[model samples]
Target chain A: MVDIPILMIGKNVVVPIQTELNDIGAKKMQEDVLYKIEKTTASGLVIDVSAVSIIDSFLGRILVDTSKMAKLMGTESVIVGMKKEVVLTLIQLGLRMENLNTALNLEDGLNLLRKLQETLHGKISG
Target chain B: MEKYQDSRDSGQGQSVSTTIFVASYEDVIVARQKVRELMNEMKFSLLDQTRVVTAVSELSRNIIVHAGKGEMTIIKYDESGRRGFRCIFEDKGPGIADIDLAMREGYSTTNSLGLGLSGSKKLCKNFSIQSTRGKGTRIEIAEWK
Candidate 1:
């Protein structure tokens, strides 16, 4: 129920939050994803939150926490393809998401992730 | 003379139109209807109307279930270029200590979805709350256009 594995499409990485990422699920997923990103040192992570429609204050706070987790592990997390209704809900809740990266769609998100990875690769190789 | 009388009476009518309410558990649905009608009179958009209704439902339910009793106030505001309403919910209940913890997802003090305060916050343009342990709590929510 918690800690689903990160998916790899070529070099792009995706983590889908399928249900309500409440207390226990959020904590467990944060640990697992942080570990995976640190181990792979992935260039970018696309968090697919499309499955989650209603994100309460707790879920929103945990999301902010998870993003921080990714940053500490040297991976950039980008949230992709949020429903407009959900966005409106989040804005209403005063859920501060200023620290997270948000993308409009999956392809655009993947492109951006790929770009980040390429840039990181160049820096390391150079 | 007729126009003068109409203006004076119309002004009085407008004041009467804007009435505040404090709803009990049984009165929450009616209270929500009143808020919806208020929004309609203000010509707020559909989304704004829905937001206010949703926020009202969540907050009112919280007052009933968590605090056992509470009071709600509806006031009109047009201070800024925008015009809308300000709703205040006050209750003498088990106050929220860890506001931050309470704000987190999945953290519910009751059997409810635990999304009451947070959801209410999201439903309005301006959301604020103040609470003390065993003292009481006050929530303010506003929607403007």
Candidate 2:
């Protein structure tokens, strides 16, 4: 998988969830993701988990927890491009993804982030 | 915690069920997935299913991550009218000192999300854990319909 650039499109922050984000390896990534959310104070976060083939219990739990964490930092977390196998494994394992919003592709995910940003902006302006 | 009103079996059956045992590395994700396969075959209730899956995954992963290396046994109980699953995960690493502190959130030995123990407790219907200082650790979780 190609390296996903942690770039900002408008006010939305995009992060790539590569294979390196597994188990303890995920701790560093989580820190970085958290830092971006706090630094940017972005309205939304788009995490690309398409490169993650397996969402183990720890990884699955962290992903879900990260979403909650993002909310606390004033950013909405959205996962994009999760494989069918990972989704099935998550379901079979009874992992909780209900709390997090997901999108089929980066475009859809970014759109939701953009919408969230617009809503936040509207709330602030109006 | 209030105990639910469910029939308890003292193991008075003649038939024996299949058991799957595996020992893996200190990788939480891999351990979690293995238990998920077993949970699916059990056909648990939606709520029970999620709890059991999370519980199994958490306990199994602990064996690997904390204990260094461990073994898990997945047992199927088909005898009698009550169908259930019984799992015993054992590890041979430095055991826990204070179970209470370990159970508490933000008291993790490792830099985990710290939800492995507490979240797992909420998921399992019957959960029991025992650990020694240097001996090992064992955790059992059972679910019934």
* Index of the highest-DockQ prediction: 2
CA deviation > 4 Å runs, candidate 2: A1-44, A48-57, A60-112, A119-126, B1-30
DockQ of 1: 0.10
Q: lDDT tens digits, residues A58-126, model 1?
A: 456667777777777677778887777667766765556887877887778888777776787899999
Native-referenced DockQ of model 2: 0.14
List the TM-score for candidate 1's chain B. 0.79
Q: Which 10 consecutive residues of model 2 chain B have the lowest summed lDDT? A: B14-23
Off by over 4 Å in 1: A1-5, A122-126, B1-93, B96-145
Report the lDDT tens digits of candidate 1 across residue range B14-126: 21223233435445555566777788888886566656776776676677767877777776654336467777788899888988887664468875446777667656778
lDDT of 1 at A72: 76
Error of 2 at A91 (Å): 16
Clashing pairs in 1: A58-B104, A58-B105, A59-B105, A92-B121, A92-B122, A93-B122
DockQ of each: 0.10, 0.14
